[model samples]
Target: MSDPVAGSTGTAASGGAPLLGAADLKVTFAGRRGSPEARAVDGVHLDIAPGEIVALVGESGCGKTTLARALLGLEKPTTGQVSFDGAPLAYDSRALKAYRNRVQLVLQDPSGSLNPRHTVYEAVAEGLRIHGYTGDERAKVAEALSRAGLRPPERFFLRYPHELSGGQRQRVVIAGALVLDPELIVADEPVASLDASVRGEILALLLSLREELGLSALVVTHDLGLAWNIADRVAVMYLGRVVETGTVEEVLTSPQHPYTQALLSVLPEAQGEPVVLTGEPPDPTRIPPGCRFHARCQVLASGEAERTGVAQSCRTKELPVLSAAGTAQVACHWAAAKAGASG
Candidate 1:
């Protein structure tokens, strides 16, 4: 019913401050003069401390990509604000250019992100050239390639996109981001296109990079298993809002939000009866008035109200913001009651 608020702090390795954050961000794209505007991201608050690897997970069209873009300064928020190092985001040419050097984006498809006509050297060096790097550009490109696990960098320097395997092309994209020596990386489905075997390698590369360079990453993905594999913290998005977020173990093993429960029930390793959501997620332009998930939530349909107000609140009251439910923060009216029953 009310705007979603995150109650969990999550596990951030850095104690002093977050390296990047989004404070109550909302991004809306206006439709035709008569049509309703599409609210892609609605009232999201997120924090990424230095060197933390956080996963933003959801089904397609859940606005994870839009939120990531807002954090990277790629898209302007319709309201609220984005911050870097405790300061509001800067938009001036000089300030924005400096910001770009600190944060880089790795798109879902490397073939689409990389230039088909450019050599590996040119692809990686583009950032340096644009950023006005006066040093030896060749050395920087070679080192970045090497860091991305493409050893003997010169071997692939002249290779075209068609020449390299799917895995290698993705590696080139990562190398391009690394060439900038960024402090944060916003990787959107970094391994979705690669083979299953290559997925592990790319994830490993991300971990190794964090260990070696102390880089913070915001990984956007739909695969819950991927979040289990590499993320220190996981934020589960439904429609335009975050429903649950916590350490990977807490959220995965004991999800509190109904949407999250439904999602995990379909996981390959999930046991017992799976929750098959009956209806399509509500359209962004016509989001339901109360709890967005109420129309399809099994919990609301079958749950016996432990108190007088729970059921009435589920359908009529605005959904509650994230509140502490054991180890996770959940935006649901009966998360505590459900946890108690399960326990």
Candidate 2:
């Protein structure tokens, strides 16, 4: 697919580190009902520096998985691009083949992802086989298993997907990705299907792998609290665009976008009254004109909403800008003031 959105055109280009970057990405699919095309992932821009973990969070159908598909070159985009190591990639056979080794992905469901018939050894060694493993396949299998914390290696080498528990199956999946020794990894809700007790173990394994390999990752999840704790940076998506992003401390502590603030405030221990968002998310088919969050925002100020007829006319009709200074970039009317105070 072509690069989706514009890349580092403004600030990301001025000075940004990019191991993997997605620029101005738009992913639209034909409507199931033969209606207008559904623009699932629209105009997203982000960069993942070498060894940094960035999480993409949003409501389920707001384009998180679709964006991941584009990033991994699994799905083509309507317009825009995703690049690796500071270079844009075309979907040629060579480029696609090279991507297989340079970047790998951990899927959400281990059971569905792994072949029930293939032994763990076969699954992990498949990457080696495809890439032309000329040496000891057994040695490669042992190394991958060890790295994924599958002790002794031999115990898991003969196990099949159904024979292992949920966490073990996930470990096998991780082992498969590791065999490629990828520079970047796109983990799509690695823990979502596991039992709650197994979630932490899987997350820890991921963190360990990151530290061991110095690998950059884009972790996708709907849980903001998970992103807050695991990600080095967080990008909040709503409708189809990235509304705010920053270092974990900056975004989590002082979120600028109402949507971002609302996301953060919903966490268990977060103070203040529970901010209930009214109305379902706007349909992706006919997104609102500007500031997609305006439909459900509490930050527009009640009186302002009444006087400006914003409730009826949307006071936030003007498209806001996304700004970054130091480690924070937020798309909000108030971010400029924060930038001013910092200056």
Candidate 3:
């Protein structure tokens, strides 16, 4: 229950420097036929310290996945920089290969991640082979399997992906990542495809990995409950940017941004009616001027913006990007105004 990022320098809560960090990162896809470019990730700054778990929470198209891909060096950023251990990430083939050896990715669907044709041992050994791991591959793979909570590692070695259950398949995928002895893992919806009963098991496995291996993670998810259960800190994304961020107890229990409040309001444990905003998220190519979330923000519609005398600013004034290093922060004109008034 301690503040995981109490004295964070935007790099880490543990104060040992960030294992991974992104600064003013942006990823854009050019459109054909003279169409406007789609900015999937726009100006995001994030950090994952050693032994820290930061959940990037948002709806689809909010750019959390794009940001993750950029951090993994999978997607080339249009601007900004990604740093690991205070060194800027390099895009050269050799450098990327070296970077990937230390930073691994766990995709959302375990079924898709594993090869149907390969046995569990082969599947997990693929990474070791790719990285030219010369040391005892068998023993390393077995250890990884055991660490991922697969009992009697050899029992599942010869089995194919189709032969394993969903949870087992996921553990196999995780074992694949662990085999590399990575310092950080970018897990994209790690448990989204599993059955309700299996989700907890996988989550517990991740937590155990963090504790046992001193691993760091950037968990890209939409589930606030999942964030609450696993993440030490939470960053709420909206419209290709982080709208709010803080410790789990701070952001989830006392959300500052309207988008975050609405997200938590709809959770099963919430007492009040959900704050349903009108219309869908704006198109990425044609992001509106000023506050990108203004069109769908409930605070503006609920008269709170007007009450605080910042309705015009909400519709016309762009808020600065949230700082990545802070213990708690929000990007909202109304929230800032409200706080100023209260002060």
Candidate 4:
């Protein structure tokens, strides 16, 4: 069945600039009083080409959300920088409004995002009003609702959030984001809470919207299944850093990072990885030294050596960098060597 969202999008040619980019972005959060602060996002670089969907996949505490917040200027980075096209944004009301008009976010929860007190029209029109979209506001609101498949637009426009189904409410959230005609979207686990039947639809919706609207989207999802279905590129984040990145085909089929291998191994056969990592990741606050994945690394150590090796890795050792001078950028010592040999 054709997704309702895909059906709503207007076909158009892309004429926009690169939607969003983060160059050497770093975000560090204060830790305990005595200890050093942890780097939530450290020297991260990312690019979102026009009309593309890039999936930032990782476990819950991997700093994916912090990067997203940095993209939105919600979390101030200690170093590095985030920009849109070429304009730098400040973390203030004026800058926020400008960023809101140019870039938008589709939050995970549909119900929480839309105000129950406001009608659908009011909710969708909120960005337009805030961003000073003065010309034909009602027409624009109706058009956005129609574009999002809240069809027979007139009836749905006046309805409240409580009046819609879960899928429909999520669509409303998407419509609200789209109403401003944003250049980029930061979708933080946009489908994690939806029903199985609805998840694919949401993903397809996001992709189709990108095609029609020329939007660059950063999709945050733990589900590799969703990334495989829609993302053009994949970035695997671990403990606040990008451990691996490449085209979806390369990363999914032959991931180079040990953490990426561990993550892929846990996926179903049709998805990726057939070998799962042995244990849980080390604590983020006290992340091991040499290689973060060294503790669970199969080839790295024996019993006492395993613990000892982790300590050695945890020291201020010079770590290998992720490179794409191949299709994938991998950070693991073994995987990088393997990639080097193959190339």
Candidate 5:
């Protein structure tokens, strides 16, 4: 059967509510008393329905991690809200605990995330204990480890972080998340640290778990290939904002925003010469007066944007809000022109 979370039908088919969502989410960090505050996550809106895997793609320092933290309520948003199952999340201690029980996080580095001193059993059992699981803890831990593909489960129960291979350590981390039987998981750079051969295995495991358990996931990574490999949808982030969002095939194959185009151009499988963007990304403390990406955008740099006066608009007007463009939603003044040209 087609999974409801995989987007084969209407939202009602998936229980009429997004499993998790963020609306107008923003997170700002105070700088020195007089200095401008740093905008880490800026007005990001996203949603994950049941059983869906959405990849959040962006370069370093683009606030993907900050957005993830906000969704989990680990970092309170400076503005906007995170909703789960159609209701806004509350910050009360009891509410936060209940939210966390349903949404877990898998960090980028297994070696760093898992305590070297804790044996595999302890690490996996920790979440169960914290959540007040009263059933047979041993069975729960073993089932979680088994689900994460550490077969026999018993074989890995006593292994420490140093004793297991990198892949195995990552699995232990995943088991910890699974032990909670969460409805959603926010995985940050889940495979960036693993060996090339092991990365595919880990990704496959996640996809399999989604099929078997009906879990939703928001996978944060800079790897376009990873999005293509596993995600049903893709969100392209730049300078703390989402510039484009669509299915993996829609966004990757025919990117609408200039930043998205520039990203796709560099993919090894892409045929053209890499599109080298000019200028370093602006400091978060002083994001440009208009579109945050206007400074480095190739389209704006080219004379094309000048002809349509879009370049001037990009420099002086507020960044365009995301709007529909065929199958994708793109935030750009020049998207229509680019889409027409591509068509």
Candidate 6:
């Protein structure tokens, strides 16, 4: 696989300008009862090139969803900027409405995303009606449905969400996004809820869509397996920040960050015993002072950092945010030190 990061240009894998990009993005929610603010997304920089698929992988509550929301303009950023086609994203109602039309969202639960009362046709046509599409609404809806793998589009036009299987409902949701002819799709856990048999079908559908439509995507998921299956690039996020990022082949096969290593170690196909970190992720309200992942870092706990004389730094000195627009990068002091020594 080709490296998606193009030095400092922040271009996509295709070497074209990013269809969507986030720079130093942060989202913070005010704490209640006079508590400190909770930083949902600290400082993330990610980009998706035209027709490229980038997976944002992390455990729950690590802020991958918040980062996705920020990219979609659903949540306002406390700092930083989101840009599409090289222009900064605007949050005003009119601007956002247009932005959403170009960048559609495909949620995880198709059942919840679709209205139980609405027929397939209504659900797919809703976007056109809202966007005031002047073209033939029926033709557009049918095309979207066909593209989404719902064959004989007219056959399912009148069907309700309850009438379709899990995979079919997901197709309808994807069709809804496709109907708008969006440039990019931000699918949050696109297949996490499906049966094991149905999961591959959905993943294949996503790949086919990318091939057919040249559509770029930012898939938010926790499953490294899913990332390996569909993503060209993978960004491993921890504690509201990206800790490691590179091509899927590079990052998954040889992950450098301890958090990423721990994640990959637990995969069913992994060679050795899993590396299980103790304790839950630290409270986001009061993140650790140095490396956000320091407390649970296995390398630090194993005395590797101590052997290398970077143990103290891991506990007290902070590392820079790994840019999402570069070659394989890691934020761990030990990993960087090891790389330097090897080089």
Please tell me which predicted candidate would have the highest lDDT against the true structure: 6
Candidates arranged by TM-score, highest first = 3, 6, 5, 1, 2, 4
- For 7-113, candidate 4 gives per-residue lDDT tens digits of 11111123344457787788887878878777778767776766777889998878899899998888888887787777766788887878878788889999999
TM-score head-to-head 3 vs 4, winner: 3
lDDT of 3 at 200: 86
Model 5 over residues 1-343: C-alpha lDDT tens digits? Answer: 1122244221333445677888888899999979999999878778788888888999888888889999999999999899998899999999999999999999989999998889999999999888899999999999999999999999989989999999999999999999999999999999999999999899999999988998889999998888888888888888788889887777887787888888878887787789998898646787886678888988888877888667877888886555212236887878765666778
lDDT of each candidate versus the true structure: 0.83, 0.78, 0.88, 0.74, 0.85, 0.89
In terms of lDDT, the poorest run of 10 residues in model 3 is: 1-10
Per-residue accuracy of model 3 over 1-343 as CA lDDT, tens digit each: 2233332223445557788889999999999999999988889888888888889999888888889999999998999999998999999999999999999999999998987999999999999999999999999999999999897999989999989899999999999999999999999999999998999899888988888898888899999888888888899988788989988878888999999988888888887899887877746787777778888989898898998999999888888877678488999999899899899
lDDT of 1: 0.83
Better of 2 and 6 by TM-score: 6
| Comparing 1 and 4 on TM-score, the stronger one | 1
Local accuracy of candidate 6 as per-residue lDDT tens digits, 214-259? 8889999999989888888889999889999988878988999999
Local error of candidate 5 at residue 290 (angstroms): 2.6
> What does candidate 6 score on TM?
0.96
Q: How does each model score on TM-score? A: 0.92, 0.87, 0.96, 0.86, 0.93, 0.96
Candidate closer to the true structure by TM-score (higher is better), 3 or 5: 3
Candidate 1 residue runs with Cα over 4 Å from true position: 1-14, 303-309, 323-327, 339-343
Worst-scoring 10-residue span by lDDT in model 1: 1-10
Pairs of residues at least 3 apart in sequence or in different chains that clash in candidate 3: 10-325
**Pairing residues by index, what is the TM-score of model 4?**
0.86
Q: What is candidate 6's local distance difference test score?
A: 0.89
* Model 3 accuracy (lDDT, Cα): 0.88
